[model samples]
Target: MSIVDGNPNVDTTVFYNASNENNLLYPDKFHQWQTRNNFKSYRQIGRFSDNEIAEHLPVDKDKTVVLIGGPDKMGSHWIKALKQMGIERSQIYYEKFSW
Candidate 1:
């Protein structure tokens, strides 16, 4: 399993903050998870470019992808990209930020 995490900074927070990610991620969480199925986490500090999205996400028929916590428009763009990669719509899930 692979995770692509994007935040304004290194911290994880429920609320908006410079270092919010620290609030959500425990120390060595990524490393610990990597023991099974080669769990990997890709952290995108600051802006998440389309290039990064294209790079991290690979085309896989058996992949289950969930797109969460981003702008609604960006989510749509991501869905489109996934479609172009031959990812089926039923295999994609998205939870867009309400705000």
Candidate 2:
């Protein structure tokens, strides 16, 4: 998963990938970029904390935002924050999956 802060002046991209044990792994190069760019990254087990939710919210409050992901509780937290920020529920889109 990745999140961009949406700052044209400060380009930042955080990447987290789940490994075999459901642990997140970050590439060395990515880590280097994060350190150099002062970007924040995380390795989450299942759910994300409110701080993490706050970090992902766009810095540009005027810009429209979209959250896309498979059905999961993590998305709910993001939806809550967006709603609290006055974004319409219709603006959020969840990708569908068929079991």
Candidate 3:
């Protein structure tokens, strides 16, 4: 997930189970992203970059992509960048979020 907050303590553990293999008494839930997912959380203090987006995407550009952006026309920026990167308008699905 992409969180633009500048808070250094914005940890992702809260979104997942804290219990690890050693803590057998409270094993992690199957749905925990930390335990079951493979992703890298980037702590960018400024604007997002194309390399950052491209690195995580599949080489096969044929697949459709989804973007969930925040308020203040946050979705607009990424949409334009994606288009410039050769992504088709029809291939993108976006949802602007306000929180």
TM-score of each: 0.53, 0.46, 0.52
The positional error of residue 57 in candidate 3, measured at the CA in angstroms, is 1.9
Candidate 1 C-alpha error for residue 57, in Å? 3.4
Question: What is the alpha-carbon lDDT of model 1 when measured against the actual structure?
Answer: 0.52
Query: Between candidates 1 and 2, which one is better according to lDDT?
Result: 2
Against the true structure, candidate 2 has what lDDT?
Answer: 0.55
Pairs of residues at least 3 apart in sequence or in different chains that clash in candidate 2: none
Alpha-carbon RMSD, candidate 2: 5.1
Clashing pairs in 3: none
Model 1 lDDT tens row, 1-99: 133244222222121112255543444655554444534455533545557655655545565454455679867977787677667788777778753
Query: How displaced is residue 85 in candidate 3, in Å?
Result: 1.3
Q: Which one wins on lDDT?
A: 2
Highest TM-score scorer: 1
Q: Give per-residue CA lDDT, model 3, range 1-99, as digits (tens).
A: 333123233322221111243422222232333343443343333455677776655566676455444554667877777787778888765676563
